[model samples]
Target: MRPTFHLKTLVVAVAAFSVASIASAAGLDRSGQDITTFLQDGLYAEAVYTYIDADVTGNDNAYIGGDNNAYIQGNKTGDVAESYDFFRYGVKADINDTFSVGILYDEPFGAAASYSGDNNFVARGDLDATINAASDGALPNYAQAEGQFDALQQAVADGATLTPQQQAQFQALGSALAIAQAEQATKGEGTNVEVRSESITAILGMKLGENKNFQVYGGPVAQRVRADVKLRGIAYGPATGYTSHISPDQDYGWLAGMSYSKPEIALKAALTYRSEIDHKMQIAEIYPVAEALGINPVQSNTMEMSTPKSVNIDFQTGINPTTIATAKVRWVPWSDFEIVPPLYNEVSKGSYGPDGLALVGYDDDQWQVELGMAKRLTPALALSGTVGWDSGAGDPTTSLGPIDGYYSAGLGAKYNVTENWAVSAGGKYLWFGDAKGQLPTKKIVGDFQDNDGYILGVKLSYQAQQNFN
Candidate 1:
């Protein structure tokens, strides 16, 4: 007799691709929070690894400038974002018939990008376009090295002999000129960036009644966030030399959910809610060398970063002897989430603010929906397919994250290696939505359209039966 699972493994394959991530969703939501670690039966441990390749493209334009002219005519900013590699693991243990415990680890949110290359928007010395311009097209007063030289000549002529005081003043002026010129020399060289976060959760489950049809679970969640950023281009203005690094911080949240399942028919329905995690980050800010001209050069800044609140509903049931149907709906309050350090607010010119506008925050929440089905073709093999849609956090978003939303499709295959082990492979493709990257002046920086993302993943699971019955 062939060892057979038939339709028993349908839900497992479908659940793997039910998540939306990469450049597909809103905010920094990278994993889609698909908690499959605790969805299996018996004493189980599982590991999954994923790789994502994605990019965004569009024309650069300012939303606020008069005539609404384009900022970058032909060159696109995000050709291919930094590739992302992620890993997740979970283990579950059942202690008797009424109590079970599980622990899970995953990346909840992240972002990575680089804006370097030849383009009119990011050429070296490009910042001087605005910095060197005179008021109303008139020659600026002592704007260049030539002007500084002329001023130094005038000072020498006025001095009767070389006094020590006058010599000291001349040295200071010379130093200031050197600093000013060097500041703009490599303005476009270091424009890379990265932001990352991870989470760990411990869960407690209790069985209600005797049949074990109802299970209630709750857990405490902990997450860590770290980021480094550097900005340039004419859009940044005096903020062009702005660079920031956020020291990592760990914070806590909570999750609660309930599930009703009938194993005989391979039916399961779960609703889970995860609370928002808040972190107060300590930051080190460095500025355009000119900022050194200020009274204080190095400053410490603190910003409050709240992850987001989310709800997920998942359902799966055997459609036939060999097939199972699965679906999911997820909601996240992305509009309420933001990252704005106090220093960014103090330096950000125009309408950008910590209270009203943001360094990077959405104008609305996000909603994601997906539908899929899985079928067992042979006792050792199963196949699954899924389609999904995400209503992005907002439209006309910030350059930091300029995606409106996406439509996605996926495929997966699972092969049972033995009675206690299985290996699964899966891949998903996303068709990203459109958005206009904005400046504080409400100018459109980039019109990102026709973007895409590709993700590949694999999973391994082991089940060990320990019956104390």
Candidate 2:
């Protein structure tokens, strides 16, 4: 009974704080591929709910100036992110002692941010100044109009009094100035952005040899993604007043892994690899204001959106009769993830992206490490604690995801209510590393410092055994 009950206690402790442990680990990574579904001993099912909140404070500055965007001007706060909830569900069945199969549902990547307050955190740069720059790029006759207006002004300054001919010329210059003012009206404000991704994975496991001590597993995975970004203040000025939408699209990938275990010592190690999922999605760009500038107002095009590939190495061993030590190292190649819209590439070729780069991308890969321990406190209760660290991909991070790195700690507990039912809960707090907001130009927009985040979660697990004759 003691050995049989230990499985339930372990499931609760592992699944309790799973969401809290990896809510903000890397680029758009909400879950760190914990693979808790494989921890079940037999037919098992689990459900989890998590609530995440983060406080990221930074200031916005005048875009016309060359100073950092985090300068404390008049704005009080730029708390663009909001609190949200997430859920996970899974089921696994052991087909005899040597073979097992399982399925898992989780949200791997997501983003949600909405700027609030009277000030324009949604668009921090100078609107008037950006129009001046945009006019030069989008307006064909802008310089000619300016030169004509200048010559008329010089004539008025030289003459003592205004003649009829000179007055008519002045009227013509006024008309040209009106045209410039109209051009300025075409610019608009950027408001908010929301992006989401969900995944479902099916897996199968087989015993390695006659001893049935080693296992190998592989599976097929599918995911869906949707995103909408309103550019009230485009970092690239000429591309402002644009909204980019990627309707929910499905993509496919695969995962494979092998595990080794020693039952007598309760030691196990597993290595897993997840392939990148590529999406060829149709993008709709709404540029109501862009059309006024003689650019395409409505555009429909297919784009290649690919998520990063990752590898996970997980290990655990019983340190003592009542304690277990566990560790994990995860690597993600985030430098491969890129979002390049058609119109953005067209305008940013010479202006924002000197090397013809993406609208948003990272410069380096990402890595995360976690060390933790679990202990049995009572016959039916177990407790766990963990500490983790993430090496930020780079400094001067994207405004879309401003965190540079993080140091985090978590605590969890599991309680068995009956022979077949168990409940668990946990929470994690992270001290986020600060970095400057960078644009496509690779210039610092502002500095974000001293921000923090937290996640709270609860989970339930049920075990069902079936008899076969």
Candidate 3:
């Protein structure tokens, strides 16, 4: 029979060329042709996405009334956080059509890990025995002025050993070491868990008109911040505790944009701006059980924080030839954020007195609004959807953390095959709104609430061909 049907048609063409070479080495047709050129170029290449999607959700609340016999008698609750996701993969090349360059390994920023340990607005144990009997009635006049400056520094190291009642007790221990160094320069240095931050950003884009759709670039942006501060709670028996582990501050900012197109009704518009990079962090203020129970010797502070400044405006139109629609807006001023740290101006100029001032001073700000739509059920299939709205900034300062205010929804899909491969998938959902605050001082008590989160993303791509002539 015709040589057994030509060896079964060469074993079905070598099993369809081994499943198209394992779907082009598993990058699924270059992430489905970069999600069909990012939904037909209407997603305004969110800062040039070779493939990136991020997510995070967080919330917090607190309430305590002034001295109604020190209120906050339980029933205060908050917390439901826990949602963060990130996935990135980028690449751009054209090195010759008036120049081009790209590299955007994403994960721009992330953080969302709940907290509410055994609720009931924590702060019980008889309120630490009534704040240790009001801090031992305000530490016996600052420990009798630190025992008259330790008996005049042990009588000047035992020199001038004469006595007229120890020179009136060394002038009352130099008037109690000048009032305990002026009340330790205004009571500075006290922390016990509060709001914190986590971050990540990578950018690289370069291009200039004449066929690359106008461009300007910038690079080098790195950040990693973590803070858990808490002050005033163990009253007079166990308070000092502030854990911060920071060391990831690499700055150098830049980013500029411009785009306009009209491939015959496949209109497009873009505007990008990313600038604001400042991180002089170097914190390692640990107190791991007060340094494994030997107490004090874990200090490292170097602060100067900044991560705010973003502006994006994208617009796209092409309601035919495969459908497309997009509109985006973003503006972040994060209330001109501030986290001074260098002893926040020497604890507000009193050198660490007045309890070392600065319990947390934030001025935050934010804004966002996006809408998207895409469809192309042919030459390789495609689909997309997006919705966003985030607005709410600063007003909750109990260490000013928890940052609530959001409402986002997303979904994406793509699957190109030839013309340089492609494949992609995305997901997002954030709806957090409900945060109250009041705890900058007044001896901590309780009231805080927050909840909502979900996000998932993926992408892949590949393009090769450009032998300029």
Worst lDDT 10-window in candidate 1: 133-142
**Quality of model 1 by C-alpha lDDT:** 0.69
List, residue by residue over 1-469, the lDDT tens digit for candidate 1: 4233343455445434533222246877788777656766678887888888877766554322343334445456656267788888889988877788899998879887767665323535632343332111122322553465456658688874646875654544443343334336555553556888889999988878778889999899999999997766544444455678999999999999998877766778999999999899999876544353342435787888899989988888777767888888889998888777666656453224445445677787889987888878887788888888989878777676677888988888877788778888888899888887765445566678888888888888777665768
Candidate 3 lDDT score at position 449: 41
Give model 1's TM-score versus the native structure: 0.84
Off by over 4 Å in 2: 1-19, 63-76, 118-120, 123-190, 234-236, 288-294, 350-355, 464-469
Better of 1 and 2 by TM-score: 1
Best by TM-score: 1
Q: In model 2, how many backbone clashes occur?
A: 7
Q: What local lDDT does model 2 show for residue 325?
A: 81
Over 255-304, each residue of candidate 3 has an lDDT whose tens digit, in order, gives: 56655655455555767776776777776654322322234436677877
- Cα lDDT of candidate 2 equals 0.69
How far in Å is the alpha carbon of 330 misplaced in model 1? 1.2
* Candidate 2 lDDT over residue span 139-225, tens digit each: 335555567667877877887566798766555444434434433443334356777888898989997776567889989999998
CA shift of 67, model 3, Å: 25
What is the RMSD, in Å, between candidate 3 and the native fold over all Cα? 17.1
Off by over 4 Å in 1: 1-24, 62-74, 78-80, 120-123, 132-185, 289-297, 349-357, 465-468
